[model samples]
Target: MAKSANPLPPRILRIIQRRRELGLTQEQLARMAGFSLSLMTKIERGAADPRHLAAERLLNLSRVLNLPFLHLVEDELPEEEAETPPLKVPLYPSLKEAQEKKTNVFVPLASPMIPLGATPDHLAFFPFPGPWLVGVGVPFLKQTGYLLVDLRPLYHPQGVMVVRFGEHAALVTAEDLTAPKGYLLSFSKGLPPLWPGDYNPELVGLVRKFLVDL
Candidate 1:
């Protein structure tokens, strides 16, 4: 079959190949690589945020697949940017606290986060090592389901985000995913977003993957 003029980068293709060569399912790879199965799927599909794929987890994936780090990401980088160091993922205070204590990070189900300074309140906590929780961004426990949320502000185009609108929390989609600080399109006119206002939205976190038990 003729390949499309625009093909997935060789880096992504190799990840899929190597995982299959090792006879590992995406979930197995996720557990081994210390990330989420959803993230593994996204990585293979070339849909994850560049920052997520460029962070240390990718390095872990290379190690797992017995491949060099650059083999998976070199094609994604520009010539001048190739030599730049990998981006360091930041841990939210909650995650940092969890990592320090060697326990599952407690995720709040509905507490709205103040992205600038104050911490959001949590209604309850779930103890999953965030298998996908330990990715490029900080993890917030705001949603009920085990959906993985990225705190780094990295996101997909027109992605869903949790934000503090005045005193309450709102799930808002990005007006333009390219700019993290861009305006957020709101769902209703009764809310603070008010039809794409001129101001930047305060971000709580970006939602990506989720897990649920039967």
Candidate 2:
């Protein structure tokens, strides 16, 4: 079967190639553009495709690299130049925060992120109905929240997972699974592990990015 086309429609390939020609690393370009190192890696590697990134982000990188705006975004107009800015996913304290529309944080990402185990139709009506959940003291996560729920687990083979057993949930590792009984895994030094119950939990989602406080 033929593979589908790349989702990176805008073709910033020239900019990335040129940056490498100038002996610049993804980290350096990220610093130059005032973007996260992870964002830069995604852009360079084509993981953060055209539809997924805001035009402003590409423009910022173009400016830092001394490239023409067209070089980074030739397919569509810059987001700031659009009639209306695109809607971003909101980070909520919980599902209730999203429903109440009170004290919810708005993340400037330009992608339609679905929940860990939800379908595309599930988010068709409410595009940004709070994909990110706030959590504290998780490894590689800042104080704000973690976008750790990987919607496409098969696509991403690595990273930690959030599992659910009946009404309870816990973070567990591969080593933890080998135990005879359930043992909740906590990366924090002082926190003790909790055993939810005797039943084995199903794999919910893989943890990916940590949305830092912005």
Candidate 3:
């Protein structure tokens, strides 16, 4: 009898093994990469190639695994000319400038004013008096007071949703009220929505005030 070939491609098999080494089940890896459980399982089982959107999913999984981005590629390419690195940003100088201009400092999500489930499909909507801040990824202690919008569900849901507040309007996810444990927030630009009926206006108002004071 002829020798049987390995089911998954070498690259993909390596990725699956790496995921296992990290003690992440296929479903867990899928959730982390914003992919569905079926899709993740298919990829691991060699029934599907993780190209295009699937490829992007793999990239996210690599980030969670703390592995190099290009490590999954089967063919190794020789290095060409090394490009110059981008200029380093000065933290103190940037902080001073932002302070002088009275810029809003983003507060991290430490403890949720309201406890919620932290599933990948849950959405967290945070309404503020002024602008809204949105961020993705697992909750890091450094980001402890801002609203965390769960993007896992939004991966398949397209179309931008907008919310108007007085003179300032913002865009937020439709299902933005369900988040797990402590919410996730960051200092990135762009505003999320303060949609009506999605949250308790009174509770949101109180949390907004508390975050601003921080």
| Clash totals in order | 7, 0, 21
Candidate 2 residue runs with Cα over 4 Å from true position: 1-87, 94-106, 112-145, 151-157, 182-192
- Say which candidate scores most in lDDT: 2
lDDT (Cα atoms) of all candidates against the true structure: 0.48, 0.49, 0.41
Ranking by TM-score: 2, 3, 1
Instruction: Give the C-alpha miss distance for residue 41 in model 2, angstroms.
Output: 26
**Candidate 3 lowest-lDDT run of ten:** 201-210
Cα miss at 66, model 1 (Å)? 0.9
Tens digit of per-residue lDDT, candidate 2, span 1-214: 9998765554667667778887998888788777898977877677765435565566466546655545455556566533333333454443334335555444343232334454432121212113322123235432333443443332332444555555444444554444465444444344435553455756654555443322
Q: How many backbone clashes does candidate 2 have?
A: 0
> What is the per-residue lDDT of model 3 for residues 4-46, given as tens digits with 9 covering 90 to 100?
8676776577777789899998888888877789987877777
Give me the runs in candidate 3 sitting further than 4 Å from their true place: 1-7, 54-56, 75-214
Position 179, candidate 3: lDDT: 34
| Per-residue accuracy of model 1 over 1-214 as CA lDDT, tens digit each | 9766656677888788888999999999899988888888887777874245544565467557765556675565555443443322222323333224443333322111112232232111222333221211323334333434454444445555645434434444544323444333332344343323443545656555443310
TM-score comparison, 1 vs 3, better candidate: 3
Worst window of 10 by summed lDDT in candidate 1 = 107-116
